[model samples]
Target chain A: MKKSIDAKKGKGPKAKLSNDQLLTLYRNLVRADHFDKCYVRRIQAGQLISFYHAGEGGLAPGVGACSFLRKEDILWPHHRAHAQGHMLSKGIDLKYYLAEHTGKTTGCCKGRSSYHWSFPEYGVFGTSGCIGAGFSPTVGWGLACKKNGDGQITMMCCGDGGSNRGTAHESFLMANNWKLPIVYLIENNGLAIFSKHEDMHPTKDIADLAKGYGMPAVIVDGQDVIAVAEATLKAVEHARAGKGPYLIEAKTVRIQAHGVGLPDLVDYTPRSKEEIDELRERDAILICRERLLTEGLLSQELIDQIEAEATQEVADAERFADESPVADQLDLSDINKLVYAE
Target chain B: MREITLIEAIREAYIEEMQVDEKVFLVGQDIRGGNFPNTTGLVEMFGDDRVLDTPISETAMVGSAFGAAQMGYRPVVDFMSGGFAYVAACEVLLQSAQHYFQHGGNVSVPLVITAGVGAGLKLANEHSVTPHAMFLHHPGIKVAFPSTPYDAKGLMKSAIRDNNPVCMFWHLALMMEKGQVPEEEYLVPLGVADVKREGTDVTVVATGLQVKHALEVAANLESEVSVEVVDLRSMEPLDYEAISRSLEKTNRLVVVDEDTERCGFAAELIAQVVDKSFDLLDAPIERICIDNMPIPGGYLEAHVLPNPAKIETAIRRVIA
Candidate 1:
């Protein structure tokens, strides 16, 4: 039996975002798409050397999920797209963030972490290389919020691939048992690094795990920024109200290959030109752009301006990263001075 | 000074730390039930929220501590047994150790992780292994195994107060071992070694339960070889200087460790000592440790484990 509480079914609190909020969500989606494109361009042009999971088609879910979040709320980023959209939307400094990505000293981790990006000031503690490991620490963050008696809530996302780990179920049960303030977000791109969801998971909705824990869960159209944001806003309110955890499974698409510098293959075969085009048609950025144009919320002049500004911002960030110094490893002759904190 | 069991010393440390800081709390499986006796009555003192008892979830148990620690709360976690520490390997080994350095030292994971480790009492393959070597392999983690009640009380206090992730694995076999502990506060700092006995002929460096075996052998052989016994209470941030000073007096080195023999901590100690003081060695070094095999249950366990007999044999071999 299907046990998920559908956010679209009007059974729970539906988000009613203001016009300004809607436009803000649209702008965030556009910037997320732009940052991803910039990252891909640099990787393709050989200007940067780093591992990045290109999130071109999947940016909306993270951007929307983080749209209503405050700077005080913790966001444990999923490895998809290296969590750039979530980080940027949650307010990680763009120039330093890009610089860190480029291995420059001006980066957030002082270039110590090329990809495990963390800005605690912005409520993002570092992410783990192991996929499902994020669940437990995120619970800890939630536990802290509960213990502090502060209204701060923790939001974390895992790929459909990572959701199957025992950590996920354990964390969920523990969080519910303690009634910790957390929003468990699922970025269901339906592909766990080339394996489709149909073959990988049973029962389609991973949020069913939430139902098993006796927690409220929702499923939303991940490409639709407004929808994702609305679902997120309601879920965030549910958790912030001391109602325990809320699970949101955003059904998104990953149009690009898992990582850059890799051939685009889905199901062990190179994606056909028509299949690629069809996937592009479902691109969250393109979809959002078309919807805004149709709604007359954004004029062609405004869209052009946003794109041009995003392009310039990306170029300036690239230049800043390229000009910055590589992180220095020496500190008064002790090479591992940064390894331990005094 | 009054004598207390090793388990009582640990309970005292928890009671003292919790009384000292409001942020200090305990989290683990059946902790509220005081199922381990060390955590007995902790819930009555600190209440449910602080003395968090969770279902059998090892990774989340540690991870919750990690989160709470990051938020500036000090948490003390007990894994029940060292062998089960592997259940939360990613959380314990990767997240706790790496989060600080990877995040540019912006976070402080101040937590003490303890597990009842080492073979004895026929606990078999799953529950009867020591895990200090696994923690020592990781750079940022601090590993300690307190062999006495006094050291258990003091070292645990230091670990709880230290601003890093610390794995303080006490010997399950040493739980009832009694020793004098001061009523007043004191600390046995990490990275320091204690010379259990002084001698001039040979130096035996050991940790955990092996320290007791070495001391017994040192006393039993006093008539012949005047043996010096060095207790390394902590592995990471090890007190190599003390070992060097002991080697300076006693030219022969023999290590007795209860863990595996092949590619083990005993080998590591010998390699490091030999590298630093090749001229100090008047004879080849010897190691008394468990041969490479899973420790068997019942009487069969004694054959593979290091005992006073093994320590005496190794000391004699190194001296001759």
Candidate 2:
């Protein structure tokens, strides 16, 4: 039996973004794509050896979910692309992010963290290297926001595979019981490393788990940035109004292997080249560009400019990272002092 | 000074800290109704908002603490029992412990974890296991196991005020033990050791309930063997200087721990002493512990769990 996909609405009629908003979405999508592509290129060239899960094919969910977030809104980035795409969309320092990836002293973490970027100054808490580590903390942050009576919302990101974990169940219960201002954005790429999501999860949609805890949620086209943002905006509004948590299950696809240097096989069945080509038919960046041109939201010239600027931005970040010095002996000698706060 | 049990001391510390700091809160299972006598009236005093009663979800509880700590709230998480910490091992042992170091040292996880450990309760394998060794092995967290009501109150207060993650364990056996606690505020300070009894012939170092056992053995052998009893209040930032200073006077070492024998706190203590103060030792060091076996059912635990008899024998062997 074919499971029907419904773009469930929450506290609003069919939501829509203005032409300018659509254009901004396109701009963000293009920038995220550039960052992801550069990340893949860097890994392929062996300029960096950090453990990474590429965010190229699965960039739309994070980019869209973060589109409406304010500077004060807290975010726990997903593991893919070292979370650079979400960081870029959320307005974090791009140079420090890249520098951290390359293990330079000017990095966001001062070269201490290899594949993590935490800019708490900008309200972006570095997601844990362990999957689903963000679930409970997001609830913690949301509880704080609700208690403070502030309109800040916490966007907690996790893969579809991690939705079945214990933290997910427990976090959902607490958020619902307390009516916290949290948005659980579950990005379903249909794979957990090599294990198929279908085999691991009993439910068809990850948001169903949220529903079990009496939490409100929606299912959207993961490849459509505008659709995701529109849905996320309604969820955010509901949360900002103190209506517990809202879950979003984005049915996306993993275009390649889980991480660089890992097998491309999904549960021992190799992902065919044809399969990847078919998945790219809905390339988020390309789709957004086409929509902007078709809807008269943006001209080809403007689209070209956006692409060029994003490319240049990524290039400048690469140069900044490459030029930064590696952390030296002095930093290593301060290990004891670094671990604890005096 | 007021006489109180270890549990009462811990409760008083929580009440005092929460009274002074608005950001300090308590979260655990059945804490509001006071599943244990310590937290019985906390909810009524602080209200449900601060004294959070959570479900049997260790991960979410710890995660909430970790998250609240990130937001500058000092959260004291009750695992109910020491073994329950393993249920959320990733949060307490890894993520929260390593957060500050991995996230550029700017963030502080000012959270306190308290749970009871030791085999006297007779809850069998799962509940009786002493899980402090794993926390001690992890670098970024502080491990403080108190042996007396006085130290328990002071250490709990210090752990609550600390800006780092601290795992504190009290022996279930010591819950009834009474000691003098000050009426005013005082902190034992994390990572500092206290010499429970001063002597001159041999040094017996112990932790948690074992400290009491070691102290008992020292008094019994007082006239025959001058035993100096040192209580290592905190295991992580061990007071190695204090240990070495005691060893300098006694020239013999014996460690008593109620936890496992191998790769546990006792082993770490001996390894550190041999490395830093090997010249101060005249006789080979001795360790009295549960030799690599889980604490069996109630009555059977005596065979494996370290007791006063084992400690006394170890002290005699160390000075033999």
Candidate 3:
């Protein structure tokens, strides 16, 4: 049986991250929230056309966990904005992300892939449009890391819906058997678009599924960046020590509609206005801000300054995306060139 | 030259490729157990680290290979049989095939998916299939079907070295068939065709096991019909030029394939030939392909598959 460690209850030891690091984590949470809100505004204004999933409440898991990874360590992100926001926090240029969104030649993927941006130079190997597809490749990356004896761990993010895929289980078995240094981070936001965890899955806890594979599993409150960082630190340490793959299920809530305030968002998500408000009150950025203020790690003035800077950064990114050139019309001769490598 | 079977030739290519490139590794089901003769001793040679025996997870294995290839490793994934390609169709077609192009030609997937194909073994509906047509239809992937031991070694080497994803279908019936393979290293380029027999009366384009049958038919009709056999070693980068050149000499054509008659490789080949050099044709193109139906078990399997007699009949009909 797998032992379930919950960081929300503060059951385990506190995270060893310094006060400066904690402040940085809080700042990233604010930045991710701001970035998401900017994208939402852009979409509403018809300035940006995108499949936008708001990462309001789920910023901590993405931002905090990614902070522990090294430059060589790879991150296989999911299609959600939380993962993209994590990439942004990891210093992936805001211009590249915005440019890719606008289908510009200056995009990270050269306007080829819109949301599924891959910058291997920044250790962001790639993300897949298909659910559960990224798991296997992350395992492969882990295998490569193990063979090279590079001590570079691979962190793969998947939703609760994607975790139910056969590929995820297969990856778990393979990673476990080979003892590949990989962290299967399940961002259990309790919603698979419209379907809730209780409706879609049999087990109450997503981490419990790891028991059958005999892998170490943990459950953490994704709203708490410190808890997430602590859980992730444990998982990363276990993997780096060659103790095999570890599973961390960060239980959080999706604060907004699945994508861009679709007409079916309210019809599909049967949550009351009161319940939605209650969920919003537990938002990670809000919680982190409160915690930072209480612990004397950040002042209201500094927090306001950080928010202003982040808003300005988003404005700058929008300008960069607007100024970036779109890809030129392809010649018939060059049509087949992109199909195969030179 | 060394006399080796098709399976031996495949095994030798893996051995040589793995011996030279540390990045080259094998991953599949029962590879360590050596259930498939082609990958029999690879585990013993390379050990478990390199020759990984994966669980019965086709999607995971293929997807992992695609990922590893992106990470600068040449992964040779064995699906055990071509029938399993259906199970891994999404990963092969969507992930591996589309990765290079979808990334704006920025990434390369050096993945070789080796599977035993064709329907002569009577392995029932699930196991018996010649589905190279499905892969050949895709744009980014390079599909190869080697009929002879020599071509098998050379093509396998080239497929491993090539940057694109290559789906290599080894006909099950021809696995043990012996053919002369040069001891020195040689690569059969992906899009090239070899003329097994040259004649003026008719031209036959055949792939995989059908290539052997086409050659046999050409030899049997030596006195009756002067037949030219063009072995299409690679299916995707199809040697249409070679077929058109052969058609220049022999204006009649008989295309032989193990796949079904409807919308298959043979049909595609004929269409391309007609498009390129329709005026050169002295007669209508004849396609010797398997009847469009599920391959039955036992004796009926032989009847459904394309044979030398079928090739000869098609050749005679086209030439007449």
Candidate 4:
């Protein structure tokens, strides 16, 4: 059972990833999961200002993929940006995010975005609740990268439902027209909030939209960390090489309800019990751990250490959130200070 | 002081700002030749890197301007026409303006969204109609409607230097009008009103091209009545003081706006005057604005835009 994990790819030698780098990514995912869990608990305790509906799944995809990105790159996420924010913990202090959610002073965006999304310094621009609204701004960042001749590219994350928004189409057309270096990631987690992708979109393949715009598109198993990472690295490389825009459709599953308030009756209604169970079995974190263990890349001691450290980090973040200051109405004045002379 | 057309004044402002500040640049559709002639001579002066002539994508252009401003550059975006602002509304009103307060004072979006407002030429419905009311309703935005060449230069310079997002509406017809401007660097403060003329019998609150028309109507009727004319240079943080002062002096008020009558600047001004300066009123406030219909074509355009005849009628009614 203890085979070399180095033979991951078809190449004679698997590309080596530093242990520190792997640990950082794993740690970020744990933090993301902890933040979302705390968000659910706080909402249940009625301590939150706005209710975000991304509590369905555990940690896996959003945080997992985000952990692989460079800190300087721009990130545009949809309404379900919980894991994304958590994974970028280094870029965004968790206290600010919690404060924002709880309408507190220490919130990343104060309480202004309490009713909606946030924009931390982590290059994560505010999330678009309006389906595909994040595409154009992300494209703008990509254009900025091209203009500045910087190696940085923008990552636009949206759901299957957002793929149909006219703004998203316009964003792609313009992105191709100007050859803006960006990566469009579609999380086809079967549902766009309440509506299933089948009922929403006429075309089954969302990635095909990229080809019409003259951009390369890829479909990947989103639940598989290695698959998602490989696809992302390819897209990142393409953009870095000035190959213009690319799209990746990640087929994943939301193992829970759309958000915290989903009626228990609707659970597994759209999806078969067997399918749901199978998807859940393929949890991204579990898959990564199993792969590491089976390939002998990580020992039991190392795994235990990571889990314990991640748990401790989550506990610390939760304590920080609880002790954070609540936001006041006068704090709204802070938002206006920088608009003009202040 | 040298004389220049409204277009020339805006161009000079861009040129002067670009020459002085390394952070200032231009972005818009067809910005190379200065789309609509507002950027004329800019490409020759600042080069392509700064004066970016973008594709016909309002969202990209506006979004790019928003990003660039976030990156510490002052972007003077030419949205071309008022209608185009609707396309980039998400970026301007929602993201650009709202971000200042929404992001908890995290980002400074020093962007100037310039567009041609009101209809004088027969450009028909798609091109005409003043849509500034939409922006005025939103906080965190500075809206400027300059009537003359001088105000255009001064206000634009002020807009470029200001940290907040400033929406500048320049009437297309006034683009060719000439006015005196100071040669030295200067900034006309935001949220301030300019009293174009002094009077006592009645007050005329005007904005954009209507300010000119109101001034003309007041001049023609000078001997008969002393009409006070106040140009609402800034629409959002409206110079309530100036309007209130005028209302206190004249008692009779007539608000003239280039935009439509419903939910327009006139409505807001009248409401404020009635609320704060109720005791100063001699008669019920009147408004001179376009009919609540789409901007018409051919001969109807002259009929559609607020005219001196309409202002005169409103003034006479209030004073009578």
Candidate 5:
């Protein structure tokens, strides 16, 4: 019998309550929310340079899936990556990411790849802006994991739009053929930029595509952290048991506009203020807080403490970005340092 | 001591390297029977896993090789022709070339992309393009255009072992041309040049199949003019040492190429000479390249390629 890890009340493992572990989860989610809020504000203030609108609210599936894994498990995030990276604290470097946005020397890529080209050492091999491009590399990493005999599973987070790409299909085929340990999580946020899921596929569930590859698929309410975490935990367990790969279609809502750009100002088919207000009440972080408080697991004082710490953390990250030194090298010849010289 | 076709030399190199290192593998279309005979007898000798056949997707093939290289595998990808290189350009330029720099030196791409090129046999417009200039312009890539079987075998071995992405072009016209090669394993490093013939009157520089034509032209003009022939084995990071030395020894110069004259290899060579060593030349540099037009197949090829007679005429004009 596997040892049950003590988690929040009505969350993770059924029995139990350690204030520390529960606090860790609560703090992580709050930090993630703080990071996303900071990121959006920076983009709005012209502080974040590479502002690609992948839509708001698409960060839940990544956060939920990553919350269950150990530090060793690598993640490959698609375009909407700030929340995912923040969840793992691997991509929480505000200075480097801000520099990357501003096309500054202090950026992660040294100003070479601005918005779309991402590289976060925090276990993110990099985000694929090319729709389904992340799929192949994710499968390759999963294959590497199998060959190395490492129990680490790679989680690839993609959007509903990327599900229709050929690379996605190919990755599924290759992952199943090789029996790689990977969890393919599709954040089905209802729309692919402008086109809705109904306008794209006949079957409402994005997991239907996984059937063609002979891989097991599941669907869950992405807004519910407990549900999302449970589904991801099950998938991770399956992969850890060497049962091959699995897919999870996370149904979530992106309350914010795609990005902090022109879309925020212009109205395409403008939603009513009331509809937007109704969606705002379903904020994942707020829902988690309410659930914990309602179940007597968390107090108002604890929630306030978590929020304060998250605010301070975000403030420190901003200062680090402000003071970080810029990379001065002109020629990138030294970039081939580790590669074999022929 | 042994004679082999252009493809056979490459096959021998692949066999020699695979036997030496288990990390090397071949992936491409129809390589089982050696698609273009470049990988002949490899599948049988190495088995299917090592010399695996791939689907007709160039992007996947190149991207897979890039991924494989990152995972400690040295992949040798063979495209049938230079035109097909365009299909794999994204993986080559964007992914393979940029990863080393983008990953902050955390990864390396030890992959060699090989293709047959040039315009003499007139395989027609699509097949016969000498797309060397495009590759030469890109940074972080090594371009090898071998004119002889010996150079092909040696340079290919170097390319396979290279850490960065390397493109080796084997001319279709020089596929059957025989040259002396040592039986032992040896490698000609990238950005090196070979002197095909020595002379003191006019330095005629060429690449790929053009090396043979330039040598033939030099021989034909033995009495009238002493023509030195230089073969640029690698295109990018060109061996300017050999060009400068040839120019210093021979006052007049002529650059012969199978591709069109506009924005061709010759144009760059001339620019380099002007920038670095213009005073060493006695006369204006002459360029003997094919006219600006698509290569025509069949008998029309005779007029499309820079032949010995054309190179000879260009050399005479430079000396006059």
Candidate 6:
């Protein structure tokens, strides 16, 4: 049965985005959801063998926040679903990304990196396999931008689990002390692997920690694209104005298992059917679809067309990856080749 | 030629490198204030932007250096003492050491980490330790342990220019040791060994502060044994060819290291020699190293650390 897009009764928050931008943002969210679904199917079918994290309910914040960044700005991403959406929105080729996942020679890191990939030309500095490991480096990027007088800002993303790391506190202290042009976007999905935020941390809101660091912070609804965009834009402006780093905590939901169907091993998700249904109703894609429909901005046919286009794009990427050449076999002498650059 | 201390030579290298390349910057704790003598006056010359002073967070500072290197900047990090490396081991090993190969050789980390090692200042175990063995065990980075002021300046210059991560270990006791350094620009290429004193009876291979002791012991034993001292300036890309040549002539080997004797540089060097040139050896090799124990403060440090007397004893034992 197809789920209907039910527009809420009363008028919602004023649409801060244009019709065209809203359409673009909606299309990106749909694309990320479709890509994640395709990844799960491929993994189950044994066609793809790699770790996967579904960014089902958090696409709005990922797309909205990343859309404001310019080509000169840098992004330090985490190793999860939001990073994929952020990279795809920033014009990183899906074909190359897919090829990388399949361990092809033409991939982003030439099949070397499975998840922690860097596309520097697009200002995606890279992601680290270790959680919160990129925080300090993000500050360094901001320092470089300031030193070069480039007027560029750095947007670093972390999950609720990563925010609790000591590296995060150290980075926050340094960024505040140096007044670096950086925006620390904490995508609080309420759970870190299996533990909820309440169980993991004492604070009610992660942004509250920013006050202790002497930096401005805000908490926004992760499901609302317009709210995320407004909050991110304000943070970006503050950093560009040389006022130092700003922290934004976007409260969202992790609607799927941490990885691709490892539920038998460990699953902390809501088990009841009604609870899962309630969580599904709050899906960012569905909410955005309902808003667009009620605002008379887009029709059902247009939404279906946009979603179909995204599915086709993912198909083309999978085909490209399937036909791409695998990495060459490494010889004993090859071991010494990459140890040193010189 | 002008004579300068090892610290002065290192400072000169920093100044010259920073002047030549605008991308080269110094970032660490107390660097701007010149708390470490090698970084003195650098902030005054390069200004605050180029010479940065970081907080007391070693992990964050080292991790930032790694990030800056990835972003096309050459960052020279000052760790103050080698013992502090334990605090940032994750950054050094997981991030910096794995950056090159992790990205499929797409990125190069041009980072130079300078740290003081060895025990002589009564600073106890936390401040004094020769941890080059730990770094040498890692595959990605280049390790340089310079004994003389000339090698210190040359090796540091080379480290700054090389498109790879390099760790230069400076002995705290050798900081004020004076030696003649050429006024003109020069760089002693890494991975090359220098023979401080040549002999034909027995070969004593050493690194860092141990090289000075080995040279002295070789000089004093001229009448009893002809001791050849090979200063392995770089530990990672060891001078195996030089070691082989020395072994062919001397037929006896004595390895001296400041690290512990078990599974340390001395053990590795002996194993390599035994594997490559075992037939050329006239007798069993001798090793002079600190026993398996923590370096304590005060005069006990002198008893644990290898000295000229220990090097001499090892040389005589090997030649006997």
Highest-scoring model, DockQ? 1
Q: Which 10 residues in a row give candidate 4 chain A its minimum summed lDDT?
A: A1-10
lDDT of 2 by residue, B133-207 (tens): 889778899999999999999999999999999999988888988999988888999878999999999999988
Stretches of candidate 2 off by over 4 Å are A1-11, A328-334
TM-score winner, 3 or 4 = 3
Residue-level lDDT tens digits of model 3 in B1-320: 66999999999999999999999999999988877788887787898888998889888788668878888899999999888989878789877888786766667889899999888778867788888889877788999999999999999999999998999989888999999998888888899999998999999888888888888888888988898999989987877889889999999999888888888988888888889899999999999888888888898888888888888788878877
Which prediction has more favorable lDDT, 4 or 6? 6
* Candidate 2 Cα lDDT to native: 0.85
Model 6 per-residue lDDT tens digits across residues B181-200:
99999999999999999999
User: TM-score for the first chain of model 3?
Assistant: 0.93
Q: TM-score: which is higher, 3 or 6?
A: 3
Sort by DockQ, best first. Answer: 1, 2, 3, 6, 4, 5
Each model: TM-score of chain B? 0.98, 0.98, 0.98, 0.97, 0.96, 0.98
lDDT of 1 by residue, A170-267 (tens): 89989999888899889898888778887878878888777678888888888788778988888788889898988988888887889997777777
Q: Write the per-residue lDDT of candidate 6 for residues A172-224, one digit (tens) a residue.
A: 98888889999998888887777778888998788878878778777778887
TM-score of 4: 0.91
For candidate 3, the lDDT comes to 0.83
Q: What is the C-alpha RMSD of each candidate to the true structure, in Å?
A: 2.0, 2.0, 2.3, 4.1, 5.3, 4.5
Q: Give the lowest summed-lDDT range of ten residues in model 5 chain B.
A: B98-107
Model 4 lDDT tens row, B129-153: 6888989878878899998888888
TM-score of chain A of each: 0.93, 0.95, 0.93, 0.85, 0.85, 0.91
Q: In candidate 3 chain B, where is summed lDDT lowest over 10 consecutive residues?
A: B98-107
The best-first sequence of candidates by lDDT reads: 2, 1, 3, 6, 4, 5
lDDT per residue (tens digit) for residues A12-75 in model 3: 5555888987887887877877788887787788766557777766777888788758877888
TM for candidate 2 is 0.97
Looking at model 3 chain A, which ten-residue stretch has the lowest summed lDDT? A1-10
Q: Please report the candidate that would top lDDT against the real structure.
A: 2
- Model 5: what TM-score for its first chain? 0.85
Candidate 5 residue-wise lDDT at B85: 78
The CA-based lDDT of model 5 is what? 0.73
**What value does the lDDT take at residue A221 in candidate 5?**
77
